[model samples]
Target: MRRLIGAAVVGLGIELVVLPLWLLPRSPAWGLLLIPLTLLTTPFWSLLHEAIHGSLVRDRRANDAWGRVLAIGYGAPFALLKSGHLLHHRYSRTERERTEIYATGRWASHAPGYYLRLFGGLYLAEVASVLLALLPERGWAALVRRTDRPDTITGLLFDRVRRRFLTQFRLDASAVVAVHLAAFLAYGRYGWMLVAALAGRGLLISLADNAYHYGTRLDASLEALNLRLPRPLETFVLAFNLHSVHHRHPGLPWHELRTAFAADGDEFHDDWFAAVGKQLRGPLPAGTLIASSPGVRRH
Candidate 1:
């Protein structure tokens, strides 16, 4: 509970209070603030991730309530973020969710899309998806019909988009849009600072999202890189650097991840930054790296 509240206060405080004050002066120094603010995203996201997995609190309602608040501050609806993440756990390394691999004879055409998604476009797409909440029920059904495929992430997502879920999605998305819009208005002439900060957040998140699973075996549903980090830094990010443990025990809270890793005799695949850096080598041909077994292995 303390962690959840602390995360909420710090994350929302930076977005709502600190950012507006920095921009109010309209000074060149505003750019300097972006670095630390951007770096703070990892911990903020870690806490939000706890809520998504229903481990932020004991009560389901309270968990989702906190998740919605954090997700709004993060600039996307909670439902959207939760749905996408759960889908990643379900479809990871499959054709639909493998962000760093390309099919034969298609690397050239897909390269632009892959790079865009890796840098900042993924978060931008998440934020922009709020617009879909404006569509009527019939419209959503039509969209599902047009885009759904059994093997694709979108299909699975749309399959779960019943009326109750859609209602909740619309409500949370409205809150997201309203909060950010008000933040921009508050920033006024210095709104560009907010824009830069969001872009930086997006870049950081997109780059890190795939680092855990990049080039891992496609057949292993729960495989992930357990990247090493300095102890202090790992604690700060809520032990999220221990990604393989989280994949194996999705219901475990952030506080328990380190112990779980130790108990399982897990090993780190690489330093966190080194694993993230590997992504810059660009998309690899599908099946370029193969694992002999279904459990965790370094790519």
Candidate 2:
């Protein structure tokens, strides 16, 4: 209940108040709010992530209901985010999931894509994916079939997409589009502000998303960096900085991740900000790093 309420307050506050205030003619002062507002997305996404893992609330149905609500405000469909996240756990560090890896001698070719994903491209892709919902059932299925590979992310998502799932996905996706469209319309002449805010949110999310897993061992599904942060800051982010601990104990709620990390006697691989910075070094050849490689430690 607290998580749901907090998410609602923060999500609605941004949508209803902060954004609209920015559009006022004399709202230059309102621009200051954008910094904290953008930063809030970190914890906002953490809350949605909790719902995704069924830890936001004990009641599964209620949890999912709140998750869809939060996800809609976050600018994507809950089902799509949930599927992709679960698949990340299932396929982490595999070729299908290694965002920071490239084939030998392909670094130059892969660098642009890697940098794009590092910035804001990942979230933009998620927002754009709502277009799939517009397709007819057969068209959606055919597209998925053409793109799906058993070892790939598309395959992972497609494998879980039944008729009922598709119906729900489409409904949730339509809701997402509707909500954002309404926001855009409300922004009127200041619509560019909404776009800029979303771009900032996307940049923050994309930059942090892969920080924990960047340059980790291939096929090490449970591996991630336990990036360090001060205790207060870590708590502020809902203990999400303890990535390796959460991966090892996915069922543990965010509040319990710190306890799990301490109980496991694990070490932080790098400072949180530093680890995120390391991604800027770009892609490396696969197999260049091992599970316990020094590179992983450095990251």
Candidate 3:
């Protein structure tokens, strides 16, 4: 009951805030509104995270329904998000993982350009990859060859990728397109604001993503890095900054995270701003390499 009510209120609030922002004028001051709006909508991802973990609600279907709704607001396909997230939890810090959200610089180059991509470029790359993923198999295969499976390509076409494209991608893609098209038709003149809102949200999400895993080692037990946020922001992000706790207790719901942290906060707490600063200042510190490379084709 608590989780459902809280998620409903937050979801409603994001829609209410975003709808009006689309009607605002396209001026410098108006553009600034996207920053707070981005913060306001950040919890949608948190709720989706809880849903993916099956902790948003006890009913499995209810969790998936809410997750799909929340993901639509953030413009992601829930099925793809679920698969990648599950892999994240299972592999934690290993290179076999398709997504870079939990990557530890273990298998790839972590140079300046790599950090730059992590900061913002990767979000744009995801949008492009999604479009490519929508293409016919032969067309996409021609563009992204069988031999070279880069992060962008692998993320969208890994193991269950075909199933996602056939079912969830087919249905969810239509819904996502319809929503954006409606928004464009209804408020085309203010389209810049919509773009700004999405870009701002992407920037903040990237910041949060880098802050969670930066400076951590590749060992599963030691990989997670927790950032201590203020009480309200911590609640808003559903204790995501307390990532180590989440990694440790994947079963706990958002509301109960504080209690778990109270009992074990010291184990993972790190300076939040300092961690963010570390990633932005330069490339990720070299991580200890794990054997069994992701590229070795199985016979």
Best by TM-score: 1
Between candidates 2 and 3, name the one with more favorable lDDT.
2
How do the residues 1-299 of candidate 2 rate in per-residue lDDT, one tens digit apiece? Answer: 48445755676666645566544446655545666777788888998899999998999998898888888888888888998899899899887888888755677898998899889999998888788887876786787778786446876675465343777778888988887788777667777777888899999999999999887777788988998899989988888999999999998999898888889888898999998888899988876876554334454
lDDT of 1 by residue, 1-299 (tens): 66556756676776666767664566656557657867888888998898889988899998899888888889988888888899888888776777787766667777887789899988999999899888988888888788786446885676565444888888888998888888888777778878888998999899999999887887576878999999999998989999989999999998899999889998998999999989887888876767466566654
lDDT of each: 0.82, 0.81, 0.60
lDDT of 3 by residue, 1-299 (tens): 45544755564443434454442434445545556666665576777788889988789988788777766666666766777677667765554432333345442465546565656665554443345446676655554355334333353444455544446655765666667666655445666766776777666666666566654545353356667778888877777777777777888998887788788744444767777666655553333344334321111
Runs in model 1 with CA error above 4 Å?
18-34, 162-164, 291-294
Candidate 1 displacement at residue 24 in angstroms: 2.3
Q: Judge candidate 3 at residue 46 and give its lDDT.
A: 78
Name the regions of candidate 3 deviating beyond 4 angstroms.
1-35, 97-112, 137-157, 264-266, 285-299
RMSD of each: 2.1, 2.4, 6.4
Model 2 CA RMSD to the hidden true structure, in angstroms:
2.4
What's the true lDDT of residue 108 in model 3?
A: 41
Q: Count the backbone clashes (under 3 Å) in each candidate.
A: 0, 0, 0
